[model samples]
Target: MGVGGIGIWQLLIILLIVVMLFGTKKLRNLGSDLGGALKGFKNAVKDDDSAKNDSTDENQPSENTDESSSETVDITAEKVAEKAEEE
Candidate 1:
């Protein structure tokens, strides 16, 4: 037989009943309200993500200590090698 014994005709009848109960105007308004609520929820989630990033940045130091020291050592070694090559 059909899906779960509910055929296409039965599904169409149910849809017709629902449309008759709510009417076209009410259904349109309901759809618009649902869309607006979803949009607002998405914006709120994005704002939360941006706020978290800002707070994390504020708590950490801008310059990492280890990286700066390693870079300075590399530059010193390069200069010493250059002077030896000139001799």
Candidate 2:
């Protein structure tokens, strides 16, 4: 049993059909674009989490919050998604 009842040969045939339909160049571009989007999403989520954690830390001094945060731009997940879709 290969992949929930489909045989190995069946899988290969499906793959071949897909390759024939899309061609390798288009498939490669699609794969890379998808991968890049996923990577960007992960980074955005990680950065957002880290920002939240830092803000919640009691040990950090609250003095001059505006001055310290001025250098960094806050990126929301929605903005990231829109940019990914554009590309």
Candidate 3:
């Protein structure tokens, strides 16, 4: 038995029929298109994961905070507001 009870000869015959219906060139083109689509999907997923990591990094407290000052500058908006009021 071949794949799920179908013999090897039967499989070959089916393959021949498929090749006859859709020539070799069309089959090659379809295979390449499918491969390209899969590659693109993989890249998109990787980019999405990296983007998520970047967003999380932005939300967390920065490690580069100035240790010399006791008061921590949480947001840059406060400094901007102060400067605007001074001006």
The best candidate by TM-score is 3
State the lDDT of candidate 3 residue by residue for 4-59, as single tens digits.
99999999999999999999999999999999999999999999999999999989
Please report, in order, the local distance difference test score of every candidate based on alpha carbons: 0.90, 0.91, 0.94
Q: Estimate each model's TM-score.
A: 0.63, 0.64, 0.68
TM-score of 1: 0.63
Residue runs of model 1 more than 4 Å from their true location after superposition: 1-5, 64-87
lDDT of 1 by residue, 10-65 (tens): 98998899999999899999999999999999999999999999999999975757
For residue 8, give model 2's deviation from the true position in Å: 0.3
- Misplaced by over 4 Å in model 3 are 64-87
TM-score of 2: 0.64
- The CA lDDT at 61 in model 1 is 75
Candidate 2 residues 4-76, lDDT tens each? Answer: 9999999999999999999999999999999999999999999999989987896777666776566665568
The parts of candidate 2 lying over 4 Å away from their true place are 58-87
Model 3 TM-score relative to the real fold: 0.68
Q: How close is each model in CA RMSD to the real structure?
A: 9.9, 22.2, 8.8
Candidate numbers, best TM-score first, in rank order:
3, 2, 1
The backbone clash count of each candidate, in order, is 0, 0, 0
Model 1: ten consecutive residues of lowest lDDT: 64-73
